[model samples]
Target: MKIAFYGSSLVSSYWNGAATYYRGILHALARRGYDITFYEPDAFDRQQHRDIDAPDWCRSVVYPATEEGLRGVLAEAGGADIVVKANGVGVFDRELLEGVVARARPGALRLFWDVDAAATLDEMRADALHPVLAALPDLEMVLTYGGGPPVVGAYEGFGAAACVPVYNALDPATHHPVPADDRFACDLAFLGNRLPDREARVEEFFLRPAASLSDRRFLIGGNGWETKAMPANVRHRGHVYTAEHNAFNASPLAVLNVARDSMAHVGFSPATRVFEAAGAAACLITDAWEGIEQFLKPDDEVLVARDGQDVADHLAALTPERAKAIGEAALRRVLAEHTYELRGAQVDALFKAAMAERRVAA
Candidate 1:
């Protein structure tokens, strides 16, 4: 199968939150003998943030960021068995839709893989960035990277023939724990860039905890966090790279996982970090989210924090042995169910189902 992915910044992991997520699915798909090509628009500053060289697993093609990007889309899209338009690419989605309608082969699988389902739909409804979402029924199928119930419910209500959630997953071989370095070692750490809507969530989930745990060390990593006055206990580091993620996870006494607007609104949705932190055997303390228990066993596989007190209590109570056990349990659960291999298998099943349905119609 020649699968073409058109969305987001695939070649760069610097500011891409979905880096691990994409790598997991694509690498697993590659292992299954599927030929994969990821298409990302070449935005300004893309050169500066180029982190990973194209690997053997999949080919990376950077198209122009403007209307000219359609040329790259048109050129590489040929001979693809499946062409995926991923959510949150922030450009030329409508043009890609037009290109698919005008140019794709009748048998070519055109899929919309929405990482942000509710947010994407909401924006479309509001005439926000992704107004092209309403044209779903004309596409082959829709797949969500997160959002379990709400996403499916909403997409179907909007008249989609097929939609499914493929949740963010882990790749154990790459993310297991390692010895920690002093620079990354801290009592508690949170990693996420600052976004407008998520700003309040950060304040509520992280900053308040930092204030409560003034005696302990807190580290914040990711971009767009500058120009904010944080408590002295909080250490603000700019974006951490993909290579340093495992060490960062290993060194933390406990890692904090905060979901964005859509993930939090939809229950049981797991972000890429949840898998990454667990795969690295880090005791994860995440903010109280709906449907969390459906994915992870609370207080065993992971710890849940609702407010500042919850965060403080979890950090203060983390014994080395206990934390290790929690991390181990989380890792085991992820390996069993949430690995990239499982995700790829799910996609295979879904893709075959769609193909068979199409065949029957013909």
Candidate 2:
């Protein structure tokens, strides 16, 4: 039951959007009598950005996280029953990854939990460090937060013993619907950090709608959005953290999701915002992607928009009551099947299977 959950600074929720997802799943596992030791590189004080810290559910070990420091820390993981090395740990290089593999105790589970599967696989395919994934047979498991079926296929194709898609799910305790506030609410708002790929999509899908409905209000939030010569009606609020995110969503009529380059291209990567928006009972309008309908019912729980005209149409067509109904339905779906607790249970099941196989081998 002793698990070494090694990854980024879950201590901070500021820039690290994955914090709640980690916390929800790990905390749920802890309640099941699993003893978790969360190892994080003591980087920026994530506590400064968020209102909380590692809950009493697990023990957190903050290491100095230099190359040498990681060597020392990886050595500490030897005693645990499972050691999970998630991508985007924010303190990784070949040395840390290789050292963990070399130093990992045989019989103890090792997981390359790729939170960003689409991007990570791309990195593995292109880089000299590609052997990192090919060495999966030596590890116990491979888990992904998104990429659903495509992720599982790729890992097994590469000769992995096991690959599981542990897609992102809701952490209902922290993400529930908030009361819609008129002052903060808008007919449609898009909240995402500005990225080159997303910027183009935003212009095509979000900005155009805002411009089309000049009489209506539109709000944009997230970091790296300064370059956009946004319309005056499109208010840009830079980098709203977890605390502010719910209010931001509550203030909007429907929140738009523009996937980043890696995710949009991959077709299965839904951002944390998807669940958050749904959980908050805020209507969601997302760009068309092949795999989206699997998670949400288009024109029902979610509105699929491929262009600015589509977005404008959704805005003009839907009433508040209907939008509320969609948000509620999406929330029900998330709560039923998409929570982080469920994702963690999925991880535990894989561990159980791996351990069972090990026993059979013995």
Candidate 3:
């Protein structure tokens, strides 16, 4: 089957946190004999800061961030078995959606893959007349990265034919225990891009913890965090690349996973960082979220914290052996159930079922 996916940059993690997730799922699908053509706009400075070129697994096409570019992308996507307009494409998302839906082949399945379902749903609920919200009913299916039943129900409420979550998973090949590097070595580390939706939580979960535990070493990795007045104990490393993730996770005594406001509010949304850190065998401490236990058991496979004090307590109580055991257990759980290969299979099945239903309807 041939799939056309239009999303954020496939070649850069500069401002794109979904890069790893995209690579994992697409690479797995390609390995399973599915052909994929990824379309990404040349805006967002991603092209200037690409970490990867076109991988042999799939064709990566970069187009201009203009009207002509949209036409070209639409033309290229015309005949695919499936066409996906992923969330956070960083340019003219509504326009892209309108065009993809209009120009898509009659038999082709159109899907809206919401990497940020929490934010998307919140916006959709707030703005009933939003073009994208109005367009939801026209799409074949809506997929999300997080939010369990509640998210699905909400999308269905918005007139979607169907909605489901394709949760983030570990790409074991890329994330695993590696020899620790001195540069990233710290008592606790949190890696994420600085975004308005998540900055407050970062302050509560990461910054406050750092302030309380001034003696313990802390590291913050990702872009756009340099301007924040972080505690002295917390060191900010701007934009840690995907290539450095394993070492970055391994070196940290216990990594932190702080969910964005929308994700935390809606629940069941585990960020890619959660799986990546767990896959690396890094003991992880995350803020309390409703469906966290579905992914990682509290205090057994992972540590759950409700506030800065909880994080501080976790850091203080973390012994080398305890950390090792927690990391091992989480890794075991992730390997057993959460892998991109598994997600790829799930996606393939969803596509097949949709096609089968379409055939029966015809």
TM-score each candidate.
0.95, 0.92, 0.98
Better of 1 and 2 by lDDT: 1
Better of 1 and 3 by TM-score: 3
Q: CA lDDT of each candidate?
A: 0.81, 0.78, 0.91
RMSD of 1: 1.7
TM-score of 3: 0.98
- 10 residues in a row with least lDDT, candidate 3: 128-137
Candidate 2 TM-score versus the reference: 0.92
Instruction: Return the TM-score for candidate 1, rounded to 2 decimals.
Output: 0.95
lDDT of 2: 0.78
Tens digits of per-residue lDDT, candidate 3, 160-241, equal 9999899999999988889999999999999999999899999999999899888999999998998899888889989888
The CA lDDT at 209 in model 2 is 84
lDDT measured at residue 18 in model 1 versus the true structure, 0 to 100 = 81
Off by over 4 Å in 3: none
Model 3 clash pairs are 222-239
Clashing pairs in 1: 268-291
